[model samples]
Target: MKRAALVPEFTVPSPERLPDMWPGREVELDGLKAYVRDTPAAAPGAEPAVYVHGLGGSSTNWTDLAGVLAGRLDGQAIDLPGFGYSDPARSYSLAAMASHIVRWVEHSGRGPVHLFGNSMGGAAVVVAAALRPDLVRSLTLISPAMPFLDPRRSLQGPIVPLLLLPNAAKLAARRMSSMEPEALASMVIESCYADPTRYPEQRRLEAIEEARRRHLVPWYAEAYVGSLRGLVSSFLRAYLPGEGSMWKMAARIKAPTLVIAGRQDRLVDIRTAPQVARLIPDSRLMMLEGVGHVAQMEVPRTVARAVFGMLDELQEDKAGRAATQQVATQVRDGVRQRAPRVRMAS
Candidate 1:
């Protein structure tokens, strides 16, 4: 396949530029307001991409990954409604989250973008891609919280029962509220990373600060609980035969996709990664050793390389098609020119 000269291949050097977390601000679009942070690309005419965080995560979760890929992709990471700095929405279901992503892409006119998601955010983008294929160019899922029929084996098992309780989110929120910010941050780091020590001290401080700020939000509990319940419901529907199944939705995705799984992910099962890759027609899988649920955070450079490789291949595919079409046109033109002109006797 011919390689396109449209852009030079992107590479990340050791100690790649890790800029401070991109400045964030509230942005309202299509009547939905979200806290968005933009990471500008150094590469000219770099394609645009959007990052969606998992449950309980904010846009800041993508800081390091986006930073390393800045030369290749201009990135925007949004705070899903009810998480981060975004205000609560009427619903925190998967469908609602997917719709918000679609609306944002439509309103911004950044269609056919490279869409990324992690954990619950991963599930949301799958729906978004299936719903509006024209709006998505490619997909990258890192430890996506796909449907797990049995949560009993994972860290999520304990939280599953909350779905049955009355105002469970509210109740959990009250408990979480009393915990110190540092403690909450520690708990999160422990759960999300294979090696909590790898977590940068600066980011840890940021996480602690976010925990403190979240306590002030009236809807924090509602958002967390609502989103979790919605995720579990999707899991049930995915196994039953129907259009609601996440597996079916994944199979319907038209964009090229890359699924990354951490071997030590305590939240999402690594076994499901293969199933997800097989279901998506144009997809590849990467399983990282000794990595946890958040590979993007644990190994940003590695993830960036895989992402850039996909883009490079996509460019080559386009070039190959163009070359083939050109040759066919030329052959047809040559044959026409060589053939004797035909005319009726006058």
Candidate 2:
């Protein structure tokens, strides 16, 4: 059974958003440069929350959800290397991605943070949390791209074989260069959303603009294909019974976790949601209906509610533990006071 958490009493907060994606600046992480959008919390003294986007996604992917949770978390959504204006990295392996996250958190001096990841980012964070437990206080995974054997129905299935081709990135880049930004955006929307109409028209326009920028970048297709190859490698490791397995890494994660899966997600299978919950010792699971791979984008309010709910439960648990300790101390003190004179021969 999933570990139990207190039922929070609060209601889901109404979403707040800007006309466009939250503005951000580039930050240097050692030699790796990354772009991140910051969303300050509505309340003071809020804990830091770092968001990592999925393959092909940028920090903008978390814009809506980050705004919705701004009351509780000081959100920073990062654009991983080779995606979304971030400098390209030498490697696109899952381990490399996790290392980037680790380095960023360390560089920020923000250890023991609330870390959030989606799809490929989710798998990366799992490794990060496992690698350095002290760096993470909590984990929230949205439709994490866990390893799956049957890719026939998955969104990435058709492209699996393409990884074997020589100069795959160059080939893919050439093919993508021939397509318009609108077409690419439309393809992503159709592939990711359970209901295309739910996506805001303005956001659709933003996506197209983002796609146009991406097409102009030298590493756009390289990043996409390279990350895909890394993800598939991770999938292969999952089947092997060894220390390199992601399942093993996930099982080692010590932080309290929240796993959100979209029932209609075409990329990651919802059937694996239970497995994810089970593997992570202290975790809560939320399966959303009529939602696709990007639940945070499709239903920001609901995602925010679940996130806040987890925070509330953790807060209550802390309070309860403190109260219990206080009562125990008081009871011991009372006993000592009553029998103090006759105690201790020394």
Per lDDT, the best of the predicted structures is 2
What TM-score would each prediction reach against the true structure? 0.94, 0.94
Report the poorest 10 consecutive residues by lDDT, candidate 2.
1-10
Clashes of 1: 1
Can you tell me which runs of candidate 2 are displaced by over 4 Å?
1-10, 16-19, 342-346
Could you give candidate 1's per-residue lDDT for residues 12-124 as a string of tens digits?
54454455789988888657677899999878989999999999999999999898788889999999999998988999999999999998888778777999999999999
RMSDs, each prediction? 3.2, 2.4
Across 1-346, the per-residue lDDT of candidate 2 in tens digits comes to 2633423335555645444688899998867678989988888878999999999999999989888788888988999999998999999999999999998898888677899999999999999999999999899999998888888759779889999997999999998889899999999998889999999998999999998998889998999999999999998998898898998998999999999988999988777767888899899988888999999899888888778878988888999999999999999999988984556678
Alpha-carbon deviation at 175 in model 2, angstroms: 1.5
lDDT of 2 at 95: 96
Clashing pairs in 2: none
Candidate 1's C-alpha runs over 4 A off are: 1-10, 343-346
Indicate the worst ten consecutive residues by lDDT in candidate 1: 1-10
lDDT of 1 at 323: 100
